[model samples]
Target: MKILVLLGALALAGCASKPVPPDWQADAKGALDGFTDDYLKGNTAAAEAEFRQARLATTATGRADHVAQVELVRCAAQAASLVFEDCPGYATLAADATATQRAYADYLAGRWQGLDPELLPEQHRPVLAGGPIGAVADPLARLVAAGAAFKAGRITPEGIAQAVETASNQGWRRPLLTWLGIQAQRADAAGDAAAATQIRRRIALAAGQR
Candidate 1:
């Protein structure tokens, strides 16, 4: 995922005065990267374990912002998979979070009121301006935009199609299944039985069913 920037920021924050332990930085990055990969591939158990390890590494810094960055990274991955949660972990550290971090948290939560789009990721900036989400070239960025659009009740059929295509192309099984399921629901709701059936077949394939 595109979380290296946030990780770098966390590392910089930790090294503002004294140098952060190299082991802690390595452990946090490795665990966080593992968590993102495992979560995207649907390895829930491994993802959870890695997430815990990442959090532990960050917590060792004794800085709430470091932990908050970890939580934000987790939430961003979940968002890409179309999983919507309260992000209570981030809320707990909101007070200690940077303005940029708070803006991102609000962006992920669909609270666009008074939000500064400039603070958001470049791929997401256009989304806040009512631009087409399909225009975002990055696969993960496209999915993030789709999830945010869905939360904002502004997701278009084209956005959903692009997200499905992106997930399928990337072999992201977890999100492929979720987006396919959503497509099936939309087709069913619109009385397109044939389309819904086709989507369900794709869902079964993604889920490793015959």
Candidate 2:
């Protein structure tokens, strides 16, 4: 009876909220809410402090450390917006990214590691609602490819630039734009100026009057 009850509890927990797809509005909203809730209740300072601690939990010297830094980015963005228009300075973006990355890592709980990529669902609705961002038939595929390339050091600056250019010429939207910009920045920082320039130009074009 106890075994059956335990299984039932696990089943109920699974039914409550499934793993959300990347760039899903619902998932993003959940993250936003987590930060906003912390930002409210006079806990902004505490949230920021938590990010700092998460940073210390990284590998001593490796990409994983950089990955951890990415989580801290979330906290910084939340802290700024919680104050309405009084957004924090541009300098806070780094911290915001680090915090965000850390938060994602926590949410992911190491599930992607060694898991069969094919087993994961192709697409999922965000925890929040938004129209389908694209018709790629496999949005998760892009994220997984990008992540694999990142882990393998194959996503160089030039590669990112090329991808951004391609995406731009093809008239991609939403999450694609976001991904291009992010990948370009990472590649540029890793020494791919061409990729960064291409991404920036596309972004400027998207904004109009660039």
Candidate 3:
């Protein structure tokens, strides 16, 4: 699906790899957490090394899925500079993100909208991973609260809209674009053609397409 192509960049970034065997997952989250802590303290060098070690530990399992997850952290460390914004270790991260967003938007143009957030699987949520380099954003509690609201059937688009705005404000570029594309699809599905068109256009602009 177009959504998968758009998200592949981030998914492959390493947080949500395949559900590995229990033994592998036991250390996966901790590896990420340790890296998170180290990066938050501005000890990126140490974090990188720590992450590399964690990734290596996955080798014993020979679980491609778990290894991919660990490698995501390793990738972050590779791209990470002493500065936080630097990551994915490859110079093409931004261009790749831009291209992916463009492809998603183009795919959505003229498609039926009416999308429901509830229909999106957990793995498909448009949230970015990684803590800030010298700062932390353990918004996990908040995320859980939001998710609970959905489970309680008390969630509102307004709340998601606010979160989307916040993500944009925080400069989480790829997630912001992905969220916008989803909103556009929902608007189309809601029969708000005008809004949908506008959203598609915005998505295009964000993707540097039109």
Candidate 3 stretches greater than 4 Å from native = 1-154
RMSD after CA superposition, every candidate: 3.1, 14.9, 15.2
Q: What lDDT score belongs to each candidate, Candidate 1 first?
A: 0.84, 0.37, 0.42
Q: Compared with the true structure, what per-residue lDDT tens digits does model 3 show for residues 1-210?
A: 111211232232335575544544445455565764465334668767766666666667655444544543433322211122322322233243333332222112211134333333333233212122112132322222233333333435664454345445544444446557657877988999998898788767766797
- Candidate 1, residues 1-210, lDDT tens digits: the string is 545554655453345588665687778888898898888889999999999999999899899988999999888778888898868889999999988889888888788878899898777898988889889877777787888887878789998998899889988889889889899999999999999999998898889998
Q: Write the per-residue lDDT of candidate 2 for residues 1-210, one digit (tens) a residue.
A: 011110111122224386642332223233333433343333566645544443333322333434333242342233212121222322343353444333333222322334433332233122111112232233232332333333333444443444344435434333345556677668677898886787678666664537
Model 2 spans with C-alpha error above 4 angstroms: 1-110, 114-118, 122-170, 190-195
Which 10-residue span in candidate 3 carries the lowest summed lDDT? 127-136
Q: Give candidate 3's whole-model lDDT.
A: 0.42
Most lDDT-accurate candidate = 1
Selected candidate, larger lDDT, 1 vs 2:
1
lDDT over C-alpha atoms for residue 132 of model 1: 92
